[model samples]
Structure formats: C-alpha cells, structure tokens
Target: MIVIDPASAVPPFEQLRRQLIDDVSTGTLAPGTRLPTVRRLAEDLGLAPGTVARAYRELESAGIIETRGRNGTFVAPQGDAALREAQRAAASFVDQVRTLRIDPEQALALVHAALRSAPTAP
Candidate 1:
C-alpha cells in the first residue's frame, strides 16, 4: 500500500522511505515480513530501481529491515525503534496539551510548525 504523492515537496525516495517506516511501525508490515525485491517494487511504483535501492539502504542502516543476500529483504524483528520513540514523544505531547487545555487542532498545528522548522541531521 505504498503511495507516491507527485505534488509533495518531499523527494520520492524520502516519501517511499517514510511510508515503509510507517508500515513497519504500525504492523502493516509485520516483523519478519518479506519485502518485494527492489526491481519489482520499482516497477510496481514506476520509480527508478536506484530510488527503491536507496530507500532500502536507508532502512537497513536504520535497522528497520535486513537483506538476506539471495533470500531478499525482511522487516526487522524488533520493529522500528525510532517510531517507538516518536510514539512516546507524541503521547507526552498529548498529555501536555491536555493539561494546558489546548485544543487538539492547535496542538497539531504546533507540531506541524515544529516539524517544518526542524533541522536535518548532519
């Protein structure tokens, strides 16, 4: 269920990367689930093989997935660690917002602003 938004400001590879992370984090792609080969997924998504490869490479680096040589790629058994951290942070934010009597929409807007202003890792 990967989707590429043509109108998005994010690069296609990044979009794919994030979607895969979300899938893995949410159990949409369960631990040990085999992933489609880079070539097959690129063909399915109408993307260059290199794009898919890059996404897979980053995923592997982040310990989200692993490549088993000829056996292909599979989700990591521990799921996404970064996603777990994000969930914890989100829960804390929700609690803080509730305590402060902020509207949910306002809290979401604040989060969006923070994300937009976030600096990239060096």
Candidate 2:
C-alpha cells in the first residue's frame, strides 16, 4: 500500500519509489512479492496512472522490481553484490553529514528523531 500527499514537497512518483525501496530494504516486501497493477495502485493512492508507472519503471531500472508481461511486477531478488552496493550508497549519506561538520552524536540523534517521528507500521 502507498499514500500520496498533494502538498508534499517531493513528487508523488518519488514518494512511491522511495516507499517501495524502503519496503524492499526492510524486508516488509520480500523478493518476488507481486505489486498491484499500475492503474489499480494509482487509483487506490489517488494518483495518476502515469505517476505509478514512472515509479515502477525507475524501480525496474534500479533492479528493485521486474515485470513479467501479464504476471505483473514483483520485487527483484537482491543478490549479495546488489546488497553491498545499497549499503555503500547508504553509508555515503553518513559521510555527507560528516562533511557538513555534523558531529556523530548529533547525526545519530537526528536519525533517532526521524525514526521516532516516522509513522508506525500497521
């Protein structure tokens, strides 16, 4: 399931994409889990079909999802190398915080605050 906010600074497609990525990374959505059809998901989320389609395309290109014609989209199996790459990409964000002169404690506190403020899973 996905939610969209018309008032969000981020675009609807990016929100959808990031949510899917988070789900996949956290294993809430396991590999090979089928995604709803674009139209259905778009309607459900009150977004344009094109928005969902664009998100799906980007996910597929990033090796996060795959489409099998009529079989629809499913989460891709993230191999060891892909997992390593994702981890490295995530680490770079921390490096950026360091470059900005943020202390480790402050950085960790910011992360904790964000985690605390995030919506709880259903």
Candidate 1 C-alpha lDDT tens digits along 40-64: 9999999999999999998887788
Clashes per model (N, Cα, C within 3 A)? 0, 0
For the record, the alpha-carbon RMSD of candidate 2 to the native fold, in angstroms, is 5.3
Candidate 1 residue spans exceeding 4 A from truth:
84-122
Score candidate 2 by lDDT: 0.83
Instruction: Give the TM-score of each candidate.
Output: 0.69, 0.66
What C-alpha lDDT, on a 0 to 100 scale, does residue 72 get in candidate 1?
Answer: 92
lDDT for each residue of candidate 2 in 6-109, tens digit (9 for 90 to 100): 88778889889888887887888888899999999999998999999999998887788889999899998875324644667669878999789998989889
Off by over 4 Å in 2: 80-122
**Which 10-residue window of candidate 1 scores lowest in summed lDDT?**
79-88
lDDT of each: 0.87, 0.83
